[model samples]
Target: MEKHGAETYGELNADVYDEWHDIDPTDAVAFLAQLVEEGPAGPVLELAVGTGRVTIPLAAEGIDLRGVDASEAMVARMRAKPGGDRIPVTIGDMADVDPGTDDRFAMVFVVFSTFFFLMTQEEQVRCFANAARRLLPGGRFVLECPTPDVARYDREQRVEAHQVGVDHVRLTTVRHDPVGQRFLGQHVLITNNGIRLAPAFMRYAWPSELDLMARLAGLESVGRWGGWRGEPFTGEGNYVTVYEKPATPAS
Candidate 1:
C-alpha cells in the first residue's frame, strides 16, 4: 500500500460506502434534529459529510444543514442522491472546515468515527478549534465516536471475517501502532466478480483526550451518552458526546 492522504479513503470507497456500511440513519437523524430544535437559530454544519448520509435527510425536513468534505468523489456521489445537491457543501478538509459563509452554525458535528481520519493529534486538535471557530457562541459541537478497543488485536495485528455471504465473503485485516494510536486497515472483498481491497487509516483518541482537545478550542463538555438514544456512558462501547461553546468567553 502507498501513503494515504486525507482524501484517500473516501476517494477509494465512495462507490460502495453507503452499501458496504449499510447503517440506518434514523436514530442519528432524530437525535440531531432534536438538538437543532433546542439550539440557537442558524444553519447546521457537518464535517467529513461523505455522501450526505445524514445531511440530506436533515435538509429534506427543512433544516438548514450544510457540509464540508475532502473528497470530491464522495461529494459528487452525494450530489447524485435525491435532495443531496440542494444542501450547500464546501470541498475542504474537516480540519479546516469552511462553508464559504460568514454565518456561524448553530451546531457542528462529525459522525461515525470520521474524526479519526485526521490521522494525528495535532490535526484532530486543529479540527476541534476549527469547529469552534465556525460555531455561534453557545452553539454545540457533537461527535459520534466509538471507543477504540485495541484489546481485540494481538501483537499489533489482527484479521477477522467482516461479511460472509453465499456468493461473497469479506475479511478485514488490521495493523495497529500503539505508540501513535493509529490503525491501518484493509478490507478484502471476494466475489465471483473477483476481489477488491479497501484500505483506511485512522488515529483514535480516548474521550478524556477529546475533552482536552475541546478545552483547547474553548469548548466544554455538556453531555456524553452510550448511544444516540441517551443511554448512560458506562466506560465501554460507542458514545455520542456534546460540547458547547460558552456564551461568554472566559476571562
Candidate 2:
C-alpha cells in the first residue's frame, strides 16, 4: 500500500470527475437545503467540496456555503464553473483546517463517503473535531456514505464493472483489508482514446463507529436515514447521519 495524501484523490480524478461520477443531486440538494433552513442560523461548511458539485447548487439556492478541499486543481476547476468563484473555498486538509477565526456554521457536512478518505481513525476523529469546532452551538454535522458490503469481495479482492458505454468502459478493482477495515480501489477507464487508472484508498467505518466518533467530538445523534430523501436506515445501503453539538448553557 503506497502512502497517498488527501490531494492524491483530486489529482487523479479531477479532470474526468464530473463526467465519470455525475449523479442527479436533486434530492440531496433539497434535503440539505431544508436542513440548513430549519437549523440554527449560520453559514454552512462543506468538507472535500470537490468541483463545487453540491456547493454550487446549494449556494444558488441562497444558502451561504463555504468549502474546503486539499486539491488546487479541483478548486481551479470549481472556480471555472458557473457560480463557483462566489463560494468561498479554502485549499487545505479538511481534517485540520480551521474554517476561520470567528466562523461558526449552522451545519458542516462531508458527503459521498468522503469521511473515509481520511484513511485512519486518528484522522477521522480529527475531522469530526474540526467539524464540531466550526459548528455553532447546537449546529448539525452531517455525513453520508455507503455501508461496507464485505460480502461483495472474494478472497479480499474484487473487480466490478462500474459503467459501460458504446465507446467507453469503467471498471473498479478493490483489495479489501478486513483487519484494518480498509479498501484500496483502482478505477480503470478504457475508451477508444486510451486507458487510464485512478486509485483511491478508504478506511470504512461502521455506523456504530461513526456514532462513537461523533460522541467523542461532543456531538449527539439527531437523525440517520438510509437515503438522501429521509428514508429509514435499516443497517443497509447508503446512509446519511446527522449529529448536533450541544447548545451552550446560559451563564
Candidate 3:
C-alpha cells in the first residue's frame, strides 16, 4: 500500500464521511457552543474540518466558526452544503494550524480524533505549538481523542466489520505499530457492483503524551473528560481535553 499524505483521507472519504461515520454531533456541538458562549469573544477555529459535519451546524447557530483542511475535495464537500460557504476555510495541513487570517481565535479545536492525523510526535507537538500561536491569550484548545487500545490487535493486526448490508459489506483491516503508536488501515467496501478501499493512517498518542506536547507549547491542561459532556476520565475510552494559553505571555 502507498503511504498516505495529509490530504489522502479527506480526499478519499469526504463523500461518504457523514454516512459512514454516523457520529452524533449533539453533545460535541453543545459542548463547544457553550464554550463559545462563556469564553472570550472571538472567532472559533476547527482543524481538519472535513465536510463541515460539526462546522455547518455551529455556523448555522451563528457561531463565528472558521476551518482548516488539507484536502480540496473535503473542503468542496463542505462548501456544497447549506451554510458551508459562509464559513471561511483555509485549505492546508491541520498541523500547520494556519487559517490564513489575521484574526486570532478565542477557541481552537480538533475534534473526532483528527489530531492523530499528524503522523508523528514532532508533528503533533508542532500542531500544538501552532494552534497555541493562533489562539488568544487565555483562549482554549480542545481535542477529542480515543484512548489507545492495544488489546484490539492480535499480533499487530486486527480486522473488524463496520457495516453489513444486503447489497454491501464494509470492513476494516488495520496494522498496528506499538513502537510508533501508529495504525495503518484500509476500509474495504464490497458491494455487488464492485469493491472499494480507503486507506487511513494515524499516529495516536496517549493523553499523557499529549499533555507533554501541550506543555512544550506553553499551554496547560485545564480540564479533561471522558466524553464531550464533562464525564470523568476513568483512564479508558475517549477523552475530550481542554488546554488553555496563559492570560499572560510566558517569560
lDDT of each: 0.92, 0.90, 0.91
- In angstroms, the error of model 3 at 186 is 0.6
What TM-score against the true fold does each predicted structure earn? 0.96, 0.94, 0.97
lDDT by residue for model 1 (78-180), tens: 9999999898889888998788788899999999989999899999999999999989988999999989999999999999997899999999899999999
List runs of model 3 lying over 4 Å from the truth. Answer: none
Off by over 4 Å in 2: 165-167, 249-251
By lDDT, the better pick of 1 and 2 is 1
Residue range 101-141, candidate 2, lDDT tens digits: 47899999888878899989999999998888788887999
Which candidate's lDDT is highest?
1
RMSD of each: 1.2, 1.9, 1.2
**Rank order by lDDT, top first?**
1, 3, 2
Q: What TM-score quantifies how close candidate 2 is to the native fold?
A: 0.94
Error of 3 at 235 (Å): 1.9
Better of 2 and 3 by lDDT: 3
Clashes (candidate 3): 0
